[model samples]
Target: LADDGSRLWLNYDLIKDAKQRESYAPFTKFIAVASDNQTLKIATEELQTGLLGLLGKKIVTVKTATTSGGIILNVNKNAPSSANISNEGYEIYTEKGNIIISSKSETGVLYGAFELLRAIQTGKSLAKLSITSSPKVKIRMLNHWDNANGTVERGYAGSSMWKWNELPHRVDPRYVLYARANASIGINATSINNVNASSRFLTAEYLEKIKAVADVLRPYGIKVFISVNFRSPRTLGGLKTSDPLDPEVRKWWNDKTKEIHQYIPDFGGYLVKANSEGEPGPQDYGRTHADGANMLAEAMRPFSGIVIWRAFVYNADPNGDRFKEGYAQFKPLDGTFDPKVIVQVKNGPIDFMPREPFHPMFGAFPKTTLGMEFQITQEYLGQSTHLTYLAPMFKECLDTDTYAKGQGSTVAKVIDGSLYNAQYSLMAGVANTGSDVNWCGHPFNQSNWYAFGRLAWDHTLSSEQIASEWIRMTLTQAKPTEQKISDMMLKSHPIYVSYTYPLGTSHMMGESHHYGPEPWLAKSARPDWTSVYYHRADSVGLGFDRTGKLSNALQLYSPEVQQKWGNPEQCPLDYLLWFHHVPWSKKLSTGRSLWDELCERYYDGVVQVGNLQKTWESLKADVDPEIFENVKGRLKIQEKEALWWRDACVLYFGEYSKMPIPKPLTPPQ
Candidate 1:
């Protein structure tokens, strides 16, 4: 039978090995739950279904286990532990011949249930099962850019999963599947609409539609949030002006918030994208970003929600640097925001480039809670055609030392609230999901979504570990086949960076669509939108100079960071072009001229894509035919597009460098 890829990583077919099935048989006799809440009920049902498939035996459900050799779910408010488990943390151990999953809350028990299933699915020995885990960040979520009209922004998959026309009455079973997939991976919150929001969502008619979706997801412990239009007071309500300081505007928002809570009492708070990319904001009325965000925060104060104010704003200054705009706008307003507001900053200073340095705003806001926004949709990284695993990309930013407090102040510590002892912390990924039968478009793209959730729960996991686990459960469990696929997934992102944006170059994608390379593009509606604005290739050099002589953007980092990246010689080769503009003839630390190295990377990337294709072809006998052919077909497209990116960028920059392609690397025809 061919796999349609509908069942994401939760594949639980009967264990082929009789010995392995026997090892899991002892714990499959029954599942006991002490509480009967909705979350616990869902956990019990999930365990039962998973066990029945894995062990081929129906597990009995009971309030309490009267015998040994059964799995038990225990909720103890005062569980003694060393890991300092939070309300949503879980501890699973073997006690008295019974596998015990204990937590302080029902939601924790649900998380533990999934973890226990993961251990069994990954073929771990259960003889001495002892695992204690908790989420590093408090709020881990996915921000969907779906529109009310059933279209999605930057969505490579099919149309929106939500059927807005049939909503509020006939709910799709896919919503439950979506919730289960998210809950299994530790995602607890989601914003279900685009940041470029529609005001109709605030009306009573649409609140009913949102409530229906929320009710289905509530059992899985997933809270629903909305991306709100900043000018709702004027659009939704008949207010004269949408100023933050206006009394009528405040009243309008307060009332609307109250009405939304009535439909879904546990709604997660607003995700606002005001004054960014032509979106309306407080600046239109002569107010600061904090003034806009604080007003919304005040209204949500009566509830347990928060306001996620986006810091993705920038101006179209042909003379000024776009890299410095986001930090300059919100860094000064750090201490001014209300307690319920978290200033959400992207992983990089610029938009979601494949390879970018950590955003300067990460550790700059000491007095305010900062949230990390990562894009998993692959909008800038080949969309659905190429396979790009993003765990390494995420870790690159998370593990970088911000030097906010001292030498060890990594971005992970700042995001987890340990560096600043912050009141709240969150990590959100721009969702890649749609109505595709496979969930994500490419079979491999699902790994990026899975990686985001796993890292969001615990940032310390290595990319290799996540890849191996995903491969074992989602694909073949054969160690040899799994290792081959794992290697491909691990090297995908860097290989993509090599051809697309080698050596810290940024934003050379085609206009608007942002898919293929358009390195020769020189004109756009805004200067920053043009490819030349970022690459800045000229007779002398082939990169933008953000050094003191020009943009002075590197000064935003700490002095410790400045010392490392300030000098062109001392900076890492990966980031050399991002901070400094060197001559084409200049020698790099790699023992090659600057122009030669760039050609080498771009050529090497195309060769690497061919290697990936060969590896996938060798595993055709081990993988599902549907999935194998799907990935194989996409790999062909990847190789074709890799050539496109390599040729365009090399030829475009070669004109400025006035140098022939290196001897070993053939020049594009």
Candidate 2:
């Protein structure tokens, strides 16, 4: 129990320095109080919990300054610097025999508390400390696609954490622990239920349960949101139809929102996945997505809540490419959505594969509020069976330039609202959490959750910075060892993508389970879900023809974007095949034919997986036994999966590419 990952990064291990301990002991001995509230109480409790574990001595709070040497939570005092300090900003320092932690806001005070714990965990001396930090993003949320039955969609980490049957009266200890972990990382809101929602969650009975969960999270400053079934008026409220423009449906939503507020005052509005994946929406009644979204927006406007309408729409047309579905559905209705309704778009058009180009709609919808929805769960990235750190993947999407207005318009700016200067901006991760003893099913997968929160807090923060911090905090801190582990994590995503879904091709995983390759499965009702539709690899060429001459998908982007990606030689190799369908013999920038390049990429992926495995093997003694063994076991699975992907993909593509494996290769198909 002591070595298991139950504590996550909140682990405040003991500091081990004789002289430095003497320097830090004065500050770690006391909790200075200037106010009272559940929030403040929580801050004190966390400080107490973190200190006693780290210093092995209880921290005593004094009404004034008891001893001349006590750590002071001086939040009520004026902050030192107003320049970088927002309300959610804080700084740590020592002066006049009191270690001072001051901030403009209570949340900032809590953050300072967490940092102090982190400093102690990393065995840094508290003397002469001056650290200031504030989140860059306004809203950071976790989207749980968990159902009423306690099952999480795409959740490889067992069932959902929320025990639906035992809520309202019964509180899980893990809920409190979970809230603390999130608050430590500045995750302010949690979209708890599935976006593919059930009307039952909106019912009064469930509201009580949701409220119970909220109470556990309230002290940590985390608000809970529920995803409402769009047709709730017709199904749950006994209305004739759930039309967005209809008076009855509008009134039903307004009253229902009011009822929800009566239970949890800080209930954080709705996350609707409407008219997508066969779910009913305004489109079902010949109304626009904006109409459906705006109805909910208007209903929640009075309560200061916002609606997050999902852009993961799938088309009913059997012939249409699913890759174009979200753009097709939302682009026309861009400016139509109410100001309170923010459109939530996934990072890519298709489901969360190992690799995908940033969604075109991220730049396409300039007039609307766009929120990023990234999947933190390794749903198709070998589930919890593989070790894949996703910070670089996140950075890849965030750093991608959209050129919507011009060249400087990056996806990170668009998501944080700097691009459009919108009042509210959101970044959501489809949570990789569960009831596992260690939270995320695989121990290393916890890095994804940590990275998401860190990035969401500040889009400017480098993934490398977050990885270094997480590795030291979550694991060991020997410089060479930390660097070694960080290198593995930082490169894990590319290695995974190289081995799994390289060249921007996606959704080759098994049809229903999404476990592995099914490149030949082309008969699914939705073409996008089928691998044959995306790759189109055959006798003549490979890759989908997204050009204007083919699917006209290139028309969705601005002229600059079309120019950037339209040409075969100029496009990034990561997405080289996504926009073009090139012949087997076409010479690439790598001086290899398209088939040979495919062979190289697929083989490169497998080799990288082996590289990650080897990197871990070399660091066996530097990391904790439990954590190292945990990742080692998972990386082994990743290697096996990598080989499975390599062999299976090469064998299948050979039937199409018709090229023998390079002369040196053994399996000369």
Candidate 3:
């Protein structure tokens, strides 16, 4: 059978190496279940299926391990003193001539089962296996931007995967496969609708459809969350006002939440996007963001649910640094939210740019639990067409030293609740999945989804390590092929950034669709919507100036951050344009004028895209024919688009710098 990407990284192709298979066949004698629960049953079945595919063996399930050289799923009611793991954590090791997958909860056993399968799939030596793993963030989730109309906002793949028109009674088997994929990656929570929510989802009719989804996901240890409309009381319940302070509105939400719980007992929680980009919120009724979130939190208090309030809000003032707005609005309200409320801040202050400095809110809101929201969809990158691996981008922000609690404080620590010892920690990815056979449009795009879940589970894993594992499991297992593809995957993001957002120039993509380059864009519906508003390109220089002279955005970060990024000479070149407005002729640390360096990066970026094409073509012998052709075609488009970006940006900015495209850097014919 041809390799269609529908299976994702869970592909269980039989082990071709006889010696490698012999090593794993010992554990296939039987899979013993310590406890028989719904989740444990799923774990047992998955292990059986994986063993059958990988070892060509039929494994039997037993109540307990009566013999040796088998796998045991042990759930310790009172966890062993030496086992340091959360309720959803697992400690897998070889013990008593049996490999034990021990956990405090059944879901942990399920995760461990997948981990064991992954080790085999990735050709890891399990001879002396001793692995202990847990999710770093309490809630690692995927936030879908799908609508009830079956269209996804900013979605570049196919139509929405929900099939909302056929639900409640006619559940699609795809939901089961989806749940299995998410469970394999340790994503325990998912919101089924767009954060720009529809009030219809709150209606009884749509609740039935959502309940159907929750049912399919529940057994896999995945919980369902809803992106709720703030004004649902007025829009759906015919209330006079949906004000958070209004008793009638409060009662309506309480009743609605209770009704939802009746249909789906484990409904995870609510995700809200309010008072920004035309979304209605508490501000419409003279209430702060806290008031709106707390009201929802109060309704969820009776249930074991949460309220994830988005902090992506910003004013339309072109003069205001939108970078500082999220901090300005929520920083003062720190330590003021209900225990159930978690502020979900985007990875960057602005929208998901090609390259962005870490959001200032990371360390600023020390009193609150802040969840990281990363866009796995390539809205500002190249959408589904370009092969851009986002793991590096995610790692860039995570590994960044926020200096929140001194030098070693990273964004990873902040969102994992270790920095200030917050109660909850979350990391959500805006999903890129759709109705495409591959789920994501491009075959390689699956890596972004895989990378997000893995990092959310353990932020310490390096991007290269994740890429290597993904390549071995999903693509070719050939060592030479894997190394070559990993190199291209690691470099893909920087290459895209080089042509599009080098030196932190951002919001330059075509205005509405957000594809291709448009740095010359000077007008849009809103002043802040225009590329010129962000790029500030002129005869003097290019890039935004967030210094106090223009906007006091730097004050939002710790003094360490401010001091580091304040001086033009001291700032890293990657983030230089984000904070400084240097003269076009000013020589950078690279020993070249700003214009020259900019031109070099743009020109070289196109050349690198050509190199990516060459790399993929060389792997044609090692990869699936269908997948190779698919990637080859996309790389062709990428190179053409890279040229489009290079010429357009270089020429447009050259109009201001009055500089040539530098020697040895000529535009494509």
Candidate 4:
């Protein structure tokens, strides 16, 4: 009952308002469920638990829908289907004074049950509830960058949630809680390890451990997927070469796939990160990406499994633009991939920066099933220290007009199979979850996870709406508090971006850890890894010239997209620096010189963090003391880091520009 954030958004704490409780009590008189499936059982139990907590009364469970004026869960064979609603979709309507949840499958009933509980927790009117909903994408998944040794790669929320040391014998209750949290938000599949995978996970020893985790998640309609090291044949089975064309290598993977199925029959196949960041792949054997992916796809095809091959591959080419690497590598292999293989591409062409144009690969691959991969973890967006609700960022990418099919071809349509008519569709988020007591480290960080799941379920949902729903369910039902929190969540991303990488000047953070500002870093193991490689700051100007002159990266996009972002004078100010290198004294559309504008943005960004701190301080009396203080402390750290970023970048860049900081702007201390 303590507000340690361990409950996440499933916090079905008793409603303190008397009138609200009275209003919900009528529907909690009795619960009737007709299905006997494990999923339905969990649904029934969840509804019962939620009703008891919210309405302060225990509801009786009935075998039939004989009892009226209570919640009824039934699987209807004919449910008046629509294009928007699939077999997994549910219809919840109030029929004859009884709330009826009708669906074609038991999984639909479970999702409906969670939706009903969400409506209650958010204090929505259940009197005339008529909601028919289905997921926009087929496979909504979470990619955890957690290693087997309990150390997460880009993870900031303590250690890995899947404790490898305590496996099949000791099942942690936390694992079940994690499933419940993900299930509540309609997340169906999860890749349990980092894409930079370990070969040990393929062995019999680790299969048992994975099976234990899968058993806990199965009841919640969530399947476990593993990130497989491509050279598992050589590393684990002692093969001479892990070539896709080699019969011995193919047989090794076939046996391994069969062995994996033996432990967990419903395992969602492998997520591979090959030939990127030093990962071994088919390229090492003079084969294409399709060769590597098809080999795994064929092995998993018999079992109805899929191979999610990551398209985040890039070379250490000093002259090559990192933004163009993915498009160049994957464009030719558009139709070459097997039917079961879905190419997982990051939302941005480069790594997950604070801001980026939508990846050109989104609409380019007309024949391939292109899945959108978003990083829910704050890898480049200030990690867990800064409070950045990424729904707005995610929506920006999803809503961008790729112009692939002339007028209104958005990225969402492409991934949802509406644009390209692909056979399979998936949207994955690099998970921010860990072994932290609060799940995500920061209290506000929980909102990013909630937002990712909500947006993945329905890309059309607005960021403000998602933020409001999360605030009401997790923090407070108070209207004023809800509005304040929602406003903060909406503005946090832009504010963080302003101080750090304003106007699309990305990858300015520290080289290795990617922590603070380091625009001066010119040397690293690889050219693309350094900050100077991206900013391209010289005595004349700053920003990478990705237009026609330098890399011609903009040429990869459709002509319509190129026309929109090509011109420096007409381009959106937010993306100005991303495409063109402007002189320090050149005037922008904002009527200020480039140097003055940059300084103002950096200084103003720090001020915005101060404003956020003030807004949060006003909620001290309204929020839970523990959670409130946790966020309060993080805001202080955010302010300090925001200042650190402002000072580091402005001073460093100013050194190259030879321009004085504008007098109106407060110079960094």
Candidate 5:
């Protein structure tokens, strides 16, 4: 993964262009800077490394630095002067024949410096450049969900990156490496433990270990948070009750937070998954989600820390669809949460499936803050083997019109606080990183991490634009190859959904691991965990009818939303089955019956995989063999799985549809 993803997008290779390099080269002849701080030292060293590689000539330190027609990295006098830069923001301007990369902080200068180098690599002319930007969201963070046992929850790769046994004393190189990777993508905050947390982390021993990692990440402008076990006071602190409003409980949290700050003053905060997923919560003591969040918020407020309360609640309810549970649970608590508490909602009502309708909470809660929680690890998608680019998946949800305020209530606007008029907003990605040599196991999986950061920074950036920039920076700067890969990436999510679960039919993946198709699986004791519970597939047709008659899940949305999605014709094609149950013979707008449409989609997925492989092959000349072969290999796996999906679905649904295979899609059997 490009040196195990240690360098990420900070790779500063020499310019492949003749003219731009010549223009930038003359400015590199002399270097003079007015500062001698450690951050400035890092900035200078970064320039040397990037310039040396890009220019193919090492730059000797000039006794004095100036902007007299030379590349200058100038920091504004009033810029944020500390170890932290806003984690990710920078400005680059080129005028008067001099390129000046400046920011309010040293790390900003570092980011700007790298951005300038990237512009050069992409062959963008540098004669005139002016840019100023910061992250669109206040918190562009990654939730590790990594356990102290070295195993990660929902981790597809081998194991977690944290080496708990040898921490605080022996800092592993992976700690620094992981920090660098996160910083490269502008991720500033990391919760170092699983949200389904254990109480062992609160021990002084483990806090010391986290402190070491925090120290390493400090310079990179990354802060560390912990997923505190809700029952920590009772389970570990020898307390009788864990009630949030209890004075003793409040005192316990205050002492705990202060102790944490003592070790790591810049600690991000706590992420609570209370009363959710069997984890102990305030509900156990008859307190509400807001009460639980506010309790933690009170503990963190003194330190300016924010508590990220997860809205991913679901019980083993036998009577109700799990999709409706989250909105039902949190919708009543609007305007109830403390300002320091941000509700973290998953991208989908269910889990992180390949394609999901936007969560209902986006435009619903106008009074309280909410955060988008995306799974970078492909839990429902094909883990590391599939070449599914998730940027498009993110875009589909972010770009959807929630229409809470009539229109233009985009999910992006909702999370950015503009729609809700809230004070703070957040975005979190369930991290996919691990101990694999390539970090994410599959080379292409890194794109999911990269895409999450790009979207977190600016949800306005189109998925295509993000993909294009990613391909150029991560693979090669060639336009043709970048466009080709971007095209493949753009079509990846839909193609996967078409082959895997089309027409909004979902929860059909293989039981347990959710690796492959198992649409017809029977129910376990917990209805929510079963595929049959979600799809409701039968002889009449496939899909859940959430209209007034059947599931009636549509009631959660606004009347306009109910009117739009309440009908099959008006509902988006992606969500057609999520709300309706049409006959197999029902004609889609494509002039094909539901059966034929399904067959077409299955075959279309197969064809798209071939097209994607061809697209990747077209870039072999420009992409390095190390990275090219990695993605090529994964694309082959995707091709095989696409066929598996097509075969399994056609075989299973052919029984219900009772339609002969189309001439173009004749099965081998």
Candidate 6:
């Protein structure tokens, strides 16, 4: 195997363990599928191909299932006993010496096929296999910040996966493979263009191109979505004013949406990033976010479409706490949005820092359908060089108790529609994929994409379980290798966090690129974009005070959450700096002074990176040489950058805290 990672986790390499292969070979006699739907055809072919590759046995395809040993895939529309399973959910079990996969729809049958293959590839026994699963979130989607000019904003992998010039005439075969990869993980939708959006995509020439991409993905049960420019009525249709209330503007949108449906009938509606980051929206005409979202939702309502309106807006006020901006802007507009509209909120209040408290909007909007937006692309984490598995980061936010309904009201429950009883629910990841040969730049980065899909399907899954499963299916089958890689993945996020922004410190990266450390950055286009605006380091103390005395941002959360994070003495150390400004001499829960604790974390972080390198190096013989070397090289860069961040922050923050670096700490070189 070349190990280029172009195959992603779909690598159906032959099983090397003879005993394990022999045990699974008996069930590889044939594949039985009754339906001739395109999705089912793909599923049937995938199973046949995977079995032949994994077991070295060609399985015959039959029209209907038989009693003998084999795999049976069926769409059971009226299985009253299995009513618990949803339309997109499936049940797989062994019956009469054969494997049976049953679901209510063809898409569910396809998902079960992939699940069956995953179990076999991961060395799970199929002798008495029984499993039933369904997606927790209604819409598991990917938001690609890819643009019409073939550039990806905040993307580290490469240029856009979409080739704008060649589409509609020359479709890339990779598009079909991309659909397969997404379908395998239960991701059902993707917004194909950048949210910053270009009006050119609305032109007739480009809609045809988009239709080409959608055609390839439709068979895999993945619907295509587009990010629409709010000013498209004026920019593309030559309208006078692009106000949501204006009849002309509304008619323009309605006609355009109808035109779009003609080409791509199953088109999933618009993703609008309006009135934020200089993007035009209804706000330019003095209208609210609900006004903007409802307008677009109405346009697509006839076609069963939706509008995913982003809530990532904030004013660049020098005195304002960015943490409070999202909640303040949207809380008052609850229940105003149309039923087809969903408010897309980011995972954290601040831009995707290495660590931050969950956004307060999760449980606040009881009347609005809230969708979670997690950055799968490592924009603030370390881009493409450092390997940081984000499952733990996402899990931390999802599992946090919002205390909205007294207790156990988790952010996961809110976004999955179990908390608010909302009509629609969604979970979206800012895609890390690009034109890179490996899809995501680093091979291990692919794990983050896999983790997002798995967690989206079932939020209850532990980060360790997802890591172990990915390691077994993609990297190695050896138990020791699986354990080692899983351990590395489990620890990678915290290690990166410690060295970069320990104790909830955030927005300390370089201004525009957001690549490396720049704690000394005092000036930028906006005060909120500067490092000083976040840390607020001064002669007497460090950290921004979000308590009632200062910004009063702590009041946004319920009393239960406020009590947990309001007091510096009781707040989790990981979130201390986010809420309080502690003196250099103040002792923390860890028994170390504030200054000493910061130094310890930075030093410990670099040491952990070294250990990760050692661990990966030790697995050279057990893993593919290409992958081992690729990760090894990236770890070296990570170590160097970790030292850079440690040195920069310790020396810079020390100027304000007026404390010496701890005696045992080695100052960054």
Which residue pairs overlap in candidate 4's backbone?
Answer: none
Candidate 3 whole-model C-alpha lDDT, 0 to 1 = 0.91
Better of 3 and 5 by lDDT: 3
Error of 5 at 570 (Å): 2.6
At residue 281, give the lDDT of candidate 3: 99
RMSD of 5: 3.1
Weakest 10 consecutive residues of candidate 1 by summed lDDT: 660-669
Looking at candidate 4, the ten consecutive residues that score lowest on lDDT are 660-669
Model 5 spans with C-alpha error above 4 angstroms? 1-6, 17-20, 30-33, 60-64, 77-88, 666-669
Compose the digit string of candidate 6's lDDT tens values, residues 460-531: 999998998898878888898899999999999999999999988889998899999998898989888899
* True lDDT of residue 575, candidate 3: 87
How many residue pairs in model 1 have overlapping backbones? 0
- Lowest summed lDDT over 10 consecutive residues: which window, candidate 5? 1-10
Worst 10 residues of 6 by lDDT: 660-669
Give the runs in model 3 whose Cα sits over 4 Å from its true position: 80-83, 666-669
Candidate 5 lDDT tens digits, 432-504: 8888866786777778898898788789888887777666666677677777778888888888898898878
Question: Global lDDT of each model?
Answer: 0.91, 0.83, 0.91, 0.91, 0.80, 0.92
The segments of candidate 6 whose C-alpha lies over 4 angstroms from its true place after superposition are 81-83, 666-669
lDDT tens per residue, model 3, 146-265: 999999998888999999999988998889889999999899999999999999898899999999999889988889999999989998899999999999999999999999999889
TM-score of each: 0.98, 0.95, 0.98, 0.98, 0.94, 0.99
lDDT of 1 by residue, 166-252 (tens): 999999999988998899989999999999999888888889999999999988889999999988999879798999999999999
Error of 5 at 181 (Å): 3.1
Report the lDDT of model 1 for residue 19. 95
Report residue 435 deviation for candidate 5 (angstroms): 1.3
Runs with alpha carbons beyond 4 Å of true place in candidate 2: 16-23, 66-68, 76-83, 123-125, 665-669
Candidate 2, 1-669: lDDT as tens digits: 336988888876665545645666766667778678677778888989887776677888876676767767766546555767777778888778787788877777887888887787766767788887877677799999889998998898789999989997789999998998898888989988988899999999999999999989977878898998998998899999999999989999999999999999988889998887788899889999999999999999888789999999886565667778889888889888899989999998777768787888988887899999999998888789877889888888899888888988999989998898888899999999998889898888888999999899887888888888887777876679888888888787787777667776777888988887788888886665677877888899888778876876777777887887888888777787788888888998887887777778778777777777888899987777887788888888888888888889888989987789775432312
Clashing pairs counted in every model: 0, 2, 0, 0, 6, 0
